[model samples]
Target: MSDSEKQCCAPKRSRAGRPPDPAKDQAIMKAARDLFLERGFSGTTIEEIAANASVSKVTVYKRFCDKETLFEKCVRKEIGRMAEAFDVGDGSSEGLEQRLNAFGLKLTKFLTRPNHVALDRVMGQEFAQVPSLGKRMFEAGPGQSRARLAAVLQEACDDGILTCDDPLRAAEDLLVLWRGFIEVELKFAVRPAIDEESVRERVEHGTRTFLRAYQR
Candidate 1:
């Protein structure tokens, strides 16, 4: 055989596997969130999530062991946003009351979204059926948020703006006093609805009430 013919007959090397894209994980989680909100937990499927995210089933499965894990990831992401808002800001120039008032309104605005309402309803309905879901959601979202709020409260105590021996207890009480059942009422579609105006009004009232209890 000619040398050129022998060279041409050499076996071609297989292509190396493509590196995993980090953005695909975000896409999968975003798609999963939309589907979960629209279809509820039982109605959604991994195949739909894969198609919606423009990723393969193997890709999805590689990141998440099961549909339940994927669902938790989506919920946790939103919950993180919620907790971020509740953690409040570190503004030395602003008065403690002002910071708290802003924080309350910020948290209200974040939680009162249509998608948030949908998530609450879906999670509430399915929490019983999926035992670990509630715990995961709590730990990832509310629990962390409580700790963050506690930190802010402790800062206020150090500043002498508030007198709180146990910041955790104070934070929990503040949350309950500010939001509490209002979230449940808003999520469940209580009469007259929980509009922006009403929510803000409630937040204002709660802030005032909380300041009275905690402020120096």
Candidate 2:
């Protein structure tokens, strides 16, 4: 009944279980993305996704509210991971060219990936069917990434590394530089697929162009 005795008698804390299987989650997301891309959001069903994922409907619902929410989370997570891969420097010792080239390559690799491209197609096809889905996609994926890039650019400007008057506008311009090439690749299929050498070349060219325009 004493304090020490009572404390000792308290229930022991339960040890946390092993971390959730990331591979399972990834499989589910991948399956869902593939289905969405192949069938469009309206065509794809939770049952189909569950079957593709080799999971029960209950499991899928436990993780996501519905098909739209699951799709949003999957696409957002993919974009978020790619954005995190960009090495946006703190405008410290690393040269502007290096930082810019790194960012360009990272963005290029991400946008060119088949899955990401497919996700874009799915969104375009579904936007009319689910108007708010477009807004959700923007806020979760590109919008978040662009905001982060703008912040980094603003820091670079503050450090006199660049002369960006409006970081957001500059970010848009930076992205636009590659839009044509990306469209060509996806549409005409004329551009080469993304690879180490190709990515390097594109990054270098983009960095030079960016600096030419923005250098103080």
Candidate 3:
């Protein structure tokens, strides 16, 4: 595929030319993301990102302050992808369980991916050394996405499909449950089998529990 339409899931490449296609920005971020996940926070560098992305150091520095900034951008980009994966339907007429089941399934599928789990582990390890990095990651990733989910939960409550005293907390709880379910067995260099049927079963169970707690 063309650079502009390159798959977001692909590994880094080396092709960014002058007159710089906006696609180069994606290339840079993609490179940074792959490196960060593979090497962790301190292990990555701007020179590496530039070389991997086939862009100039000046190009990388122009967009990010340092390695930290690039790492943050990568986290944001990945989380943005996760958020985009969930439909979280806009005020659908469907029952709360139906909508949540779909959301849970998509979320589980994304989180259970081996690469995604590895990325999360890297972020977790980095966060221990750099607290602010974790904060930035939360704000950009789960923090922003949770707000969107909270809004949807509030809408559901208002529509009388659910009974949540604090929609934000409820949304957060759902996210926690979803993450816990999918990440239960994920560990570095240890990827256990997670079939489609198992994922759907887990999503169904989680969605059912969430609904039971909130259903009106």
Quick one: best TM-score, which candidate?
3
Q: Give one digit per residue, the lDDT tens place, for model 1 in 1-216.
A: 233322312223336755556788889999998898777777888789999999877667767766777776765676556545534445442456666666676677667667667767767767787668778767766786677778878988888878888999998887777676776876767843567787778777887787788878
Q: Candidate 1: what lDDT?
A: 0.72
Candidate 3 TM-score over all chains jointly: 0.77
Which digits, one per residue and each the tens of the lDDT, describe model 2 over residues 1-216?
233322312123336745556676677898898887676677788788889989876656655656768878876776666656455555553565666666667777767766556556656766877779888877877797778778877878888878977999998887776443764576445654567677668667766677789878
What C-alpha lDDT, on a 0 to 100 scale, does residue 174 get in candidate 3? 84
lDDT of 2 at 214: 88
Q: Looking at model 2, which ten-residue stretch has the lowest summed lDDT?
A: 1-10
State the lDDT at 186 in candidate 1. Answer: 68
Which candidate, 2 or 3, has the higher TM-score?
3
Please give the distance, in angstroms, between residue 109's alpha carbon in candidate 3 and its true position after superposition.
2.9
TM-score of 1: 0.76
Off by over 4 Å in 1: 1-19, 83-95
In the range 1-216, model 3's lDDT, one tens digit per residue, is 233322233233346633546787899998988887677667787788899999877667665656666777776676566555346555544555666667667667867777667667766777888898789877876787777678778888888888889988999888776666447567644547588788888777777778788877
The TM-score values for the models, in the order shown, are 0.76, 0.74, 0.77
